[model samples]
Target: MGEPVNREKPLRVGIIGCGKIVAQYLESFRRLQDVQLTAVADIDMERANAVAAEWNDGGAGEGGVRAVGVEELLAAPDVDLVLNLTIPAAHAEVALAAIAAGKAVYGEKPLAATTAEARRVLDAAREAGVVVGCAPDTVLGTGIQTARKAIDDGLIGAPVAATATMVTPGHERWHPNPDFYYLPGGGPLLDMGPYYVTALVTLLGPVVSVIGAASHTRAERVIGSGPREGERIPVEIDTHVTGVLVHESGVLSTLVMSFDAVATHSSNIEVHGPQGTLAVPDPNHFDGETRLFRLGGSEWETLPVSAGYVGSGRGYGIADLASTPEGQEPRAGGLLAFHALDVMESLLDSAHSGKSVAVTSRAERPSAVPLTSQEG
Candidate 1:
């Protein structure tokens, strides 16, 4: 690939959503020297104005980063990229719009609500000659990267299998706007499987086929927090999902994603080989402890952090994408995100059909992050 893009200049960015997750990206942008926040936009003018007012304080100069309508922001000549934090349903629409405007785009997880939509986004970017990046940049963090280093270094002889487990009572218990969690695009697997699937792809490789089964326990959920507290939302998708993925490299990964369960003591993910087993940290966060157990060892031993962007979080992917050469894929590029989404969607298809589903999309494993800190 071409040499990494120079980091001396900042990438001018415009954000397109102003929801709860926007706060995390805003916080990250403050510490990421390679990015410059220039504008904010949303369907709700009030929310857009509020976010612009809060983050633009003496930052963008002159008008100081005022809020604009989505169309205005998309057409802004000064904006080099669009940060799409909109809900899953709107992801592809916003991305296609930005690409049509000739701007690179980075978005929150699952890439799009469906692989067909995600494919369109990628195709549009290719036609527009703009880059596409997606989140759960959490994989670029030390947690998953360190575990990846162990497997790459032969701490695990030859990866044979893996298991990923995530369970919670439900997001309605805590999320302020929890209606989306019960929608078709918001089931447990689609909602949270991105992290686990992406981590597995990072550690193992792209999956080729999958078999799945799923269940839904409740028809409605009560909002337990925010303005919607005590509000009941209808559930339209499966709440619990299980699947087994066969990776291109022949490694098998068992997955469990649930919104109906009480809890799980299992490590977020565990990979096994002939010589050892590895306990990888949660893939939703940037840093954590990774432990390893050799076949003959009596107890698990914690492994030191050896790779990834140190002290990184949500928006690191944007910074990483900003520094990637024009023609190269970002470490958190859309291809990997598309692959993960395809895997999840296929799993759900298998669940409904009671048969194995083949994954038609694939992604090359992203380049490993060396031990490095953010340049500030």
Candidate 2:
């Protein structure tokens, strides 16, 4: 266990990386009393300044969020936790820096570039006695949590298999900085697979082994919408990846992730069983309708909102972490992120080796979220 959280005070937060995703977290921080956004930083100082200048707390408290250099944010006495939103490749580096500075950390997913690097980050946090939380906290919201409750209630009756599918043309179309998406740690599987994989583990259990294959569809892609529109960028990682995961619970999950497809009609995730099939919502979003089709039923039915943060978003995981007891893992914790990373990396390894790979790492299925309201 790490040092105990002081229940009377809010966890002061400093955010690193002012990319597109920072906007979402900013909105959530406005709602969470468990956390206070104290500072914003980025390699691009202008971007950091803009974020600090734009955020408003509606006169709640804390004076205001200020812009700071990366080094300055890490050194700030007010920041009790560092929110690392850097690119996948920089995840471990930033987390280690924050841990070195004696701050808790919560980052956007895939944990790190690889399981080995993620292991280093977690080891350092362990040695430093700081808590580490990672995202795709979307699973902590109603969609997946309701689905989880359904299965736990035996609505699916011993899940036999599941299919998770996510396909996108690419992030270059919308993101101003899209260069990192094609890098080693930023491929389709590594970039987007965390949501599906983490959700699968949340609803099912940890994976023990996996078989996989992958493809690279193009040499380069043109920026579709951004300051650099029409500029072509080289693709370094496989754009499409498919894999089958063998779960420790005897459940199997088949995953399909691709940046090559224009679109797809498949449900984000579907679980099958002797009793029924569940159409889980897109794991990327916080809330959506979860539908169910029973063995003898002719029509699909939508499940009621039975679990999760009713209207939560990106950084609720940090609030969850702040509220977690001393010895418990946050719903979106590092162990799960590391296990998900190992699964994806192993899938790619299996893709290259043409053989099944054993996933040596495993994480407990994170605790399910009860129905919650963060409206305070």
Candidate 3:
């Protein structure tokens, strides 16, 4: 592998899709000396103007990125990287456009609506020869890294099984536009399953087989928190999904995701081996501490939070990269996304066919690829 890239030249970034999340991206982008927040674009003109004003007034940088349409942002010469923070459905279109415009892309989770769309984007990026990165890059954070180190050092003898869960009360209760969550592309499996599945794939090898079951908890959900409050929303997608992932390394993984369940404990992902158990932190958030539970040990030992992907809420790692010298790379990239999508597809198919679905898509870890620009 080549040596990590130095953050000598600032990466000029243009953000597409101005929304509440833009604040987090803008906040983080302003802190990074190696990154210049160059521009902003959104379908909503009012939202674009508001975000542009905020960025220019110092929410992002002294002179913030220009608020423009998608085409203008893509055409902007100063934008070296395009941030695809658009809603999940629009991710592929914006990312494909950015790649076509010969700019690198950094996108939010799920990569795309389907495995086919994700593959198309991947092919386009390869054809364009520009970098394309995905979010929840928390796999490169201290929690996962420390656990990986311990496993490498034989702290956990050999991973045997894993159980991951991401359960919540659904998004229609919060997000203003919740219609997308019920569409064919939207579901708990495709929405929140990325983080749990990606983290598992990062730790374990590729999956070999999958059997899944899925169902809808409620036929309709009421909008709880927005202008559409008290409005009934029909649930067109599965609200609950469960799957069993068999890995190439002989490890088994049980995954459960739901939008209607009230989970008391945090979303826990545990890997069990002969020697010990490693409880990885939630990969959805950028930074946090993890714990290791040795077989003979009395308690779960706390792992230090050394990495600096620290920000409030979702953009901690992005913010840390924007502010610090740490040049971040996509830990949860296309491969992980593809694998998760494949797993979800298998689960849905298995549920429908009443049979175990074999997962054919397999990815070998790239020996020449480094997870991040920051190396120890």
Q: Assess candidate 1 and give its TM-score to the true structure.
A: 0.96
* Backbone clashes under 3 angstroms, per model: 0, 0, 5
Which regions in candidate 3 have their CA more than 4 angstroms from the true location? Answer: 1-8, 59-62, 306-330, 364-376
* Model 3 TM-score, 2 decimals: 0.87
Looking at model 3, the pairs that clash are: 31-322, 31-323, 32-322, 32-323, 311-316
* lDDT value, residue 145 of candidate 2: 95
Error of 3 at 361 (Å): 3.1
Model 1 segments beyond 4 Å from truth? 1-8, 58-63
Which has the better lDDT: candidate 2, or candidate 3?
Answer: 2
lDDT (Cα, tens digit) per residue for candidate 1, span 184-295: 7788898899999999999999999999999989999999998989999999999999999999999999999999999888999999999999999999888999999998
Model 3 alpha-carbon miss at residue 304, Å: 2.9
**lDDT values, one for every candidate:** 0.91, 0.91, 0.73
Candidate 2 TM-score, true structure as reference: 0.97
- Cα lDDT tens digits for candidate 3, 47-136: 988888877776545455678888999988888778888888888988899888888777887788877888898888777666666776
Q: Which candidate leads the pack in TM-score?
A: 2
Residues 1-376, model 2: lDDT tens digits: 3343454689899999998899899889888888888999999999999888888435534699889999999999888999999998999999999988988899988799988899999999888888899998999999999999999999979999999999988999887779999988998998899999999999999999999999998999888886899999999999999989999999999999999988988999999999999999999999999999999999999999999998999999998998898778788999999999999999999999999999999799988889998756
